[model samples]
Target: MTTAARQPIVNDDMHDIITHVNEGHVPELLHCVKAYTPVQDATHVQMTAVYEDGMELEVTAPAGLSRHFVAYAVPGPAHEAIRGTVGEAMKKLGVKPDSRVAHWCLTENRALTAHFRRLTVNLGEDERADWRPGYACRFDVPGHEHGRPYTLRRVSGTTAEVDVYCHDNTLGSQWAEGLQPGETVTARGDYQEVTPDFSAGPALLLGDETALPTIAALLEGWADEHPVRVLLEVGDAADQRYLDDVHLPAGAHVSWLPRTGGSGTALREVLDALETPPAAVWGALEVSAAKALRKHLRTEYPDADVRVTGYWRVNEKN
Candidate 1:
């Protein structure tokens, strides 16, 4: 287990890059630092937060403290074009990247249903053990440039599991379909506080299939006095039935909202019309839905604690 700590700036190139970035020459800096591909090794940093100026990451290649900014104006969304920065850094250090991105090999892969696969990875002896529950890891399969965030289902020892919802014409679906043991894939985790804070009171867990694993973690170790309700949107009857199999905490009630094509539109509508707001809300949904819900919740229940994120974006051209 790698102990995460804050180390003084050891990489000189990193300091130089930050120096140029401070001069408001981010585009110029990117032109010089851009890598043709993601630089992979036995370890890499996981992005934790994004902002207009730069992004924050949890460095695993050399595990360190919480999050720190790598100065540069993000060209687009937080997840877009991040590898180039990481790759440039690794390359300058003369580290022969092992895989263009830090990756974990599959230890176990099982089918939960037609559309969901339970994938597991052993973090190995070299990986960090300070991982918390309720967060997600972005996975990138070989030959796929874009990555998708999959919630960490469970972690035991050095192994962790994630439930991937596979749909046709998706990169994740293709990877899961042909998955085999010993094959390595990229996994990145961002900042999501797993330390339960029910200080606001009972929580309302909401979202689609992507939110299930995270919701389950939130229910664990919860006090019996705290009331929790889950409002989920799934594709069909089979998806709903699968949720029933998961053993949740006491007094946890799940309401299944079935959709025809497994879309977030229905769920978004319900959330928009929701009259009763909970003391706290946690959700992971599609990009549009997550943003809309967050805005509405903040506007309506300004005092209620909310932590909602867009687990993935839809209709992306690339």
Candidate 2:
């Protein structure tokens, strides 16, 4: 639970930083004093203190010595790189990152079905007491620049469970398949809620195998006030196990589409044949298919609230 006030500008860190800059970046400090402050006749400048929003400076002007502060272009309590485009987008928006990049050890690795493996990590008493429900985090994958995101399924005490389906040859799939007990994984920031509201009307959710975990998570917590239809396209029938334990509500139905022709073939056929347009649409699939399907949905159902994400692109590393 490190916060900006707690860890951003610690005394030891500040001392080291001040020493480094005073010794090396003196010219830059002088430039800052001249350009930023009202000290136009300043002769010499030295950095005195550093704050999260700005740096305090000791300016030597023609008149006398005075103190001034120069604000940082980007504020500190700065977060290092976060995984996934969602994190990048957050950074671009200047959203203060959640300081939760921590190590979680592999406690349990068991199979849920033919291709799905359930991984449980020990988050310890600190995390258990602080973790909020509906927060999903990204785990660091070895050799990958930005690791993949896994849906945090459930938490009991200090342990959290996440399911990884490994039927594909993706890097994340292999990484999950190779994980063993005692090994540690880095949990990146938790920014988004895995499940979104699809309780508006007769909503349509179309997803491929990659979206299985999120789809199941979404359905389990559904409001169940509206009619919902789920269409899942899987390369093999075994992937249906990804949703084996998901309980569908009274007005909810799931249809499994087999990949016969190619990606999105079955989904396209189904969408084209639908007589009544849905009020809302959500889909996660390969890049081209997701884009094309979004265009089709926008064209046909102009009034629908549609959201389609390119989970993965064809012929590209996952």
Among these predicted structures, which one has the highest lDDT?
A: 2
Model 1 TM: 0.64
Which one wins on TM-score? 2
Q: With candidate 1 superimposed using the best TM-score fit, by how many Å does residue 54's alpha carbon deviate from the native?
A: 11
* Candidate 1 residue lDDT tens string, 1-318: 112332333232333233324333333233223332132221433444444445544433333333345644335433343545545655665655444234777987888876788888877753567666655666776666657767777777778777888886577777876788898867764434332256567777888877777877667646647677778888755766556556787777777887644356666666665545677887878877776776776677777766666767787566
lDDT of residue 26 for candidate 1: 36
lDDT of 2 at 23: 55
Off by over 4 Å in 1: 1-103, 189-196, 221-224, 260-262, 272-276, 316-318
Model 1, total clashes: 5
Model 2, position 89: C-alpha lDDT score: 37
Kindly report which residue stretches of model 2 are placed more than 4 angstroms away from their true locations once superposed.
1-99, 126-135, 193-197, 316-318
